[model samples]
Target: MVHSNRCGYTYIGESGRESCCYRETWDDRERCIWHEEIAADETKPVEQLERARAPPEVRDLNGETGPREILDGTDVRGTVFPDGMDLAGVSLRDTDMAEVGLRNATLTGASLADATLVDADLRGADLRGANCWEAELNDIHLGEATLEGADLRAADCSDAILRAANLEGANLEGAFFDRADLFDATLSRTRSYGAVFSEARANEGTELDERCVYDHNSDADATRQRRESGAVRSDGGQASDTTVAGSDIDPLTKAEATYQELESLCSENALLSRQSQYFVRRQDIHTEEHWREGNWSRWLRARLSRAVVLYGESPFRVLSVTVAIIVGSALLYPLGLLRVSATGQPLMYPSPTEPIALVSTLIDSLYFSVLTFTTMTFGLYSPVGAGKLLTMLETSAGIVLMALLVFVFGRRATR
Candidate 1:
């Protein structure tokens, strides 16, 4: 006797507790629609004149037939919402909602802790601030859903399809996301300490905050300390986005760890192109961190890497910078930087020794500048007094640029 026809749903309120007595029967079962044992009962669609009718309370909330308040606190656990449902702020912890069709449902602030939501269809659902701790969410289709600030800590989300979902500031600590698809998902500010992302699928569009290192040490406990902090989230609820942070570990260390972890994931999934993207970002954070700590050598190397080849990500930039150097050096050469090797005559714009054509002087200076930059000067021209120093600088810069270009080209070819 799993159920009776008295609609015996219990509801506890601030005043007292009460049991429902709605006279209805879901098919041949001895219960109302709200009290139906949907998980246990097997059925086939058929015309039955005595079938149960939907109560006036939960009448078409998503379609705006009724307000969202009527269905709150109702015991609709183990019930399937095939079309769509609006149960915002509903207390439905520990429900057997596995394999249900909840497409486009509004469950904001609902308590779904320990619920079995395996293979459920929650695409485009709004679960903001909903407590879903330790829920079984494997293989659920939550594409384009809004789960911002939701508490999904320790939840089993393995094999879940979360494409384009907004999980910003959500508590994802210790959650298992193995083999989950997170393509184009926004996980910025998510507390993902001890969270397993093994084999999880992501791309360049997947947003992750390198500086979000909210580990267990930084956050005292999941529930109690967070509630005490009273920090409101971006979605108008309490989330893991509080400004309180601990300095026990360097932020760059955690940021590098995150990048390395993701980079390895990309490499294993044959997404090698995304690996360089992560590498450049990792170096950026490393450079910024070292600059603040006064590490001149590390900062200088990182800065040079960016200026030369964009940390070896952009091969085009290498060629562009080289061209810029050559053109700039050519313009600087006309200011008495070159001389004739045969006559030892200085090459200047006005030419105090003789009236030189400005156009011809510029052409000659450009030719000399190109030869000096390539470090292959002929006997027809020579560097004058100050030109010797300028030539040395230009030659050094050219050598470094050429070497970096080769390295960048080789790296890009492998990718």
Candidate 2:
């Protein structure tokens, strides 16, 4: 049996702490909207009712018989616009145009608060100064659209295609852009507080401000591309306006300056990925000799470390080197270059007499090579003659390898 509140909703689950009272707050005798007492006199706001009513047949903005409408300030709430419909400056507050075709629509300054535009085809639309608060724009295609100064608070734009879109000075607080295509889009000064951009592809020209906090698991490659390409300037403005006095700067020179600036900024901030990308770009653009002139030792060491340890990111490379060293030592041992001996006794040289003897000697040599390479001693075998020198070399290599492994693992842990 279920315990029912005055709203007729059930209180299910455990009786005490783990129960759910599916009803409105009980403070001040409040009841759910569906409760009979509340439903009797419930009435929607007049503005909402007016918005719920459908608009007249679409027409041109000039009051002509054309399909497009320049009905600026005209309320077209709840209207289903046809494909290629132009409703520039029209008010569409609380409209229910779900699955409507609005491709190439001119909805500039349109009010779309609490509207349902699910699956709307708004590609190439001009939505400058538009209001889309709490609107349902899921799967909307807004590629190449202009949304400058648009307000999109709490809007759900999941899977929206916004490639090359302009969202300058837009307020996008609490909006969702999951899997959205924002490649080359300009989001300068766009408020993105609590916004979700997981899996969104933004490249160079995708400007950002300090307020933006994306999902940590978002596409790192896209972020790096934006940073390296100078698409992600700190200020929410056009890249041309970044340097006040460089208005006449040539494109190549400006690009180079931006790269250097970003490189310096990223290095200071300890943004290693962006810094590495800039370093690589500098290497590619400059002459080989010129690029390698200054800090030659530092550059050489950095490159060598990356190759040997994969920038301290790969354990497989470490393992491969270890295996190669062991194999090389094993092969040398079997060539009669590593006879075993005791500290004060004669050396135990290999005798390739019978097939069994040769096989046993080879196996023993391989085992001894492995033990020496690992710097481990069982006291049962010791190196003689040239083997002593090899043992010392192998021990030193093993120590270095072990130290590198430790450093790599520690760096990875902190990262």
Candidate 3:
């Protein structure tokens, strides 16, 4: 058990255990025999873990202020209280109170700008309007705390627990939140430009401020869309409530909502194409039973979706595929698989009347390939008897490629 000399409270538990309500560590040698059993109880609730919680205490400079009098106090700007102290409403500007254990305290309007609060246990504390600018708050626990209107600009909150904290109207520009657990924290109207939220967990009711972009591969973009759309939450915990009753919701209403959801997902199809495809396929199947019947057709469609338009997300892939087909077909002509004619007469690779170079023959073949691929009747070149079969196949492929290219371009241009 650990005893506080300042507050007269006894904290009985093992050190560093989250289940212990006490912020300070327990010393076994100082513990009584009866308190040993309480220390071993791991199943104790975190809020109820403390057997005795001392009343709020203050350690003033003169040591004369009473607990009630400290509530209305303010001038403790730089006093060092090197212990577990709860000094609410105290103005501690430019204070160097590093590694302090002020858990669950209410420090509303306290000015702690330029303070050294590294590794502080500020869990469930209220620091409304606090000036913690440029403070080193690394690994601090502000979980479920309220820091509304706090000046946290340039503060390093790396690996901090800010889950469920209310930080409305806070100025957090250039603050670092790398790997911080901001799950369910509300940060509405907060200026967070250049703030690092790398690997930070934000969820429902977590309103991110402007210019707060995350990694390309992270769920931050999706979470932003969901939160801004008011459709989904970042936590993936629950869905938003609708005004209409479930029983009374018509199929048309459900369909419209689903369409909006699919549209939103499709808009971000570069990262959400699979999810968008699922919804699109479901909707397509419901409208036409034929879409659900053919396995080969669906398989072909899935492949086409990936290869042609890349699920309506990439135009580059479509262009690359089209170029490959045209070039591949053109190369086959130079290999003597198909014969070409320039004037409706049979033409060999080595010209009899004029000696054509290998490069010239290849260029003519490419020209013919482009015409054949586009199905254009320029009549500059014609395929010989057996070559007609290859020409017909090329023509069919050209038509399909043209249609797919148009579709891809349309999606790209609209997007």
Candidate 4:
């Protein structure tokens, strides 16, 4: 018979001559005494062992105000929990501290490279100049923490709340920061090349140096349009829609109109071309009338042309016209066709050859038409005599053309 001392469970069995003092039966029997002892020891209360292992509180050496560093080394790559301790200059590379709280601690100059700090709380901690390269720091709260000049390159910090943290000059290259809250955090001079920030919310005045690459957001389309159209000029210039002839329009209102026109045209063209083409290809149509009825290409071309006119002239075409107008006007200024008279005075400087002057005048007219159409006033040439009437007509025509061009170009660019 064998008795378990820890739980008081007794068993009667044949002990084949194995000597064991824990046995209660009178028969001499052999048994695995060492194994029985291990089984009995495992059943003992765990609380008793925990109580025995508790360390007594030692008096502070000099009544210091911060945590104490217990471990030291360059290759110290793990958690060193001298709990409630200050571990300044400790090297904790490749350590796992998931769900651990290191509140009110100072780990200045620590190298925690490739460490896992998932869901860990490092609130009010000082981790200045730490090397945390390629660390897994997802969902970690480092609120009010100091990480100045830290090397956190390629760290996975998705959903991490780093509110009011100092991360100046930190290297965070290729870090995954999806939905991370960086409210009021100072990221001046922080290197974050190729960092993922999908769905991340950052307010205005967020420091985004040349190292950062911002992905397209839903509002990005509007912002980009405003930028490209010179509607949101960053040179401190006023956002004015003054045409070449000094006609003003609301920038935002114009953008909205252009957007709507482009959207309509694109939808119409797609429906006519794609749907009609698919239908024609799938079904056997024998008559020419049927083919004309389902003429997707012609319909698309017409719709696109209308859209182009509504939005504005094509960029290349507008550029070509502007150049032609400028050159022609310069040539025509010397001729009698284009002259600038000072205040109600008639001045005509007739050139030598009438045919040459006429040709120059025609070129000038074409150039003037383009400029008027584009609403770009060169201010170098003016009309005198009969040219004044022609200039008035061209100016009026130019205003309409410019308006149309703005509408078309704005829609196309925004879309």
Candidate 5:
């Protein structure tokens, strides 16, 4: 039997135990907004569970706007005397939660992945361990929210106000932080690889790792690796991972464009080395896309450029490639036509007819190769037959390599 004066919200556990916690009641009704029973004598929260489990359209049709339909002038959600509106542990995944007033709501352990929470007021909510991966958190007011261990990977949190939010150990990989206000946010040990913090306002109290970088790996694989290593959070909870199903819309192209804007952000911050690293990563992804499209010519070009100079990030590779070219050209010159400038007497490596030393002919070929590579013809040696064409090719290669070397050096020296 339940008391008629108090709120009668009954929570039935998986073990089938019906427990009714004491809550304040309305003066005219038997229950408060959170604990309001649809039926006069229904003790179990059967209708509440059914409403939560309903489909998206079904919930909309049944008015998923929450109990704000009833006026509580004395109190508002999120600012209650002791406890707030209890929506805790609700599975709101893939629901249209946009512009909803969940302020001060208790959403702990809620499955909100892929939910559109744009402009929702969730200020001061307890959202620990919530699966919000890939959720649209744009412009959401989560000020003072407790988000420890929350899965926010790939979530679009652009322009979201998360001031003073405790996001310790949250998985924020690939999450967009563009213009997001994270002032005084406690983000200790957060996995923020691939998260773009472009133009995000933060003070000294905001614990952000300056060394955070994008390593181009999936969030699930990273989480699984951490779990396999038996890692635990600061709150004495074991690290857990959740696999998100595909979203309704694939934003891969938008993500690529967003990274381009992030690249500019790095340049604005004078992080040239980081910018170069990001450029290489973007090119690698594009090259992979080309490979998937079966564009063999583009793939070959990308591979050759990467091998030659590592996309201009490695200058030593460029020098080594030039050295190899010089050596190969020198060895090939002896096999072609080589003649003295004063006389048309051809010099061959074997010297079958004349009895000239092999070493002398080889040295001459090496000298000519160096001169030909630099495009510096001293008129001491001449080339006929195939040697003329080989010298032309080597000269062109020298010109291209010298320009590339200059560009690489300038790019590295600036920042």
Candidate 6:
């Protein structure tokens, strides 16, 4: 036997074994007792009838329409939409409507404070000016929806698909959009203070403040196209057709095109396949025996050291010095003090009367002068007469300059 607290009645017999008491029929004596109790219970409830059968307009706080709808501005505290009906503009404070389908509905100015919308399909819905404070909207498909001027404070929208949605002037403070697809969505004037978008894809013109985190390859193609053409699509529709054709192009057509292109380039050469090109030789290719001897950190440190020495601060300083030497030689060559040897050698002090005619001779003199100043003294040429004194002064200046450069470079490298 099962007892029902609603009617204060006891259900007896094998029929009472069912899940619901209404599914079973009462025995003759039990039915008589149930009817008598119900009749007596109804007699003393005139005031209770008035309260129960009162107009819904007086009961509803928001004055919203319909059996499926709550009146607008009604305070539906802790109410639920069990029939999957529209509750647009219903002020549901602290309501629990988890996994509800409020799709394509206009929830304009609705107050859904602290509501749980986990796994809800609110796709293409107009939630303009809606207050979804502290709501849980995990995995919700809010694609193509408008949430203009809405307040989504402390809402969790992790992994939600908000593709092509407009969130203009919305306050998304402390909201989580980790791994969410916000592709082609407009976020102009949207304030996302302390909001996280770790792996979200935001396209061009999507206004973001300092709080937005983006990946390296995020919208790279679109960005490049926009930069090159000043717009996204720019192929006159032919490029789009080609792209679509490439996806569905036959293997025969691809092979024929490849053959034609190869034929034009290598008219005299022979074409080889994978098997034909597979030639093995017994040459020792200097393989490292202890490939895994060094740890990744150590290898990285060695690479960084080499890069610093070869391509970093030192190289830049060297380049600057080289440029200075070249410029100085070019300047000095016209002055007639520097002379070039028939054989390529360092610059030598020449007879002041000798005519500087040859371009090659000037280049050789410049190369030698730079070498002499750098203290690389190739010893192939020597200054004669009054030229020796000038050479000596230049060599001394070069040594001092080189020393200063080395010191500066060393300090920079260490830093």
Most TM-score-accurate candidate: 1
Q: Rank order by TM-score, top first? A: 1, 5, 4, 2, 3, 6
Query: Which segments of candidate 1 are over 4 A away from where they belong?
Result: 1-79, 164-174, 183-197, 202-254, 258-275, 351-356
Cα misplacement distance, residue 164 of candidate 5 (Å): 14
Tens digits of per-residue lDDT, candidate 4, 128-199, equal 877666678999888888888776756788999888888876755456778777766777655443455655
Model 5 clash tally? 1
Worst 10 residues of 2 by lDDT: 66-75
Using TM-score as the measure, name the better of candidate 2 and candidate 5. 5
Which residue pairs in model 1 clash with each other? 4-30, 5-30
Q: List, residue by residue over 283-340, the lDDT tens digit for candidate 2.
A: 3333233334686766676666655676666666777887788778766765545544
Candidate 3, pairs of clashing residues = none
Better of 1 and 5 by TM-score: 1
- lDDT score, residue 303, model 2? 64
Candidate 1 C-alpha lDDT tens digits along 231-289:
43322323332222311335456556656666666776666666776687677877888
Error of 3 at 5 (Å): 22
Q: Which residue window of length 10 is worst by lDDT in model 5?
A: 67-76
Candidate 6: C-alpha lDDT: 0.49
The C-alpha lDDT values of all candidates are 0.69, 0.57, 0.54, 0.48, 0.65, 0.49
TM-score of each: 0.68, 0.40, 0.37, 0.41, 0.52, 0.37
Worst 10 residues of 3 by lDDT: 66-75
Expressed as tens digits, the lDDT of each residue in 1-415 for candidate 5 is: 6677666555432233554635556447666544443342323332442332335454344344331111111112122222365555554554555665666777776667666788878899989977676788999999999998887877899999999999976877668888888778987656554567888766645664332222234343454345222233221233334222212112343334434654555566565655676577667767777897899999999998898878888788889988898888877777647788898787667856645577777788888888887888798888889988888998998888888898888878865
lDDT value, candidate 2, whole model: 0.57
lDDT of 2 at 289: 34
- lDDT per residue, candidate 3, 50-79, as tens digits? 223334342343234321211111112222
Error of 4 at 350 (Å): 18
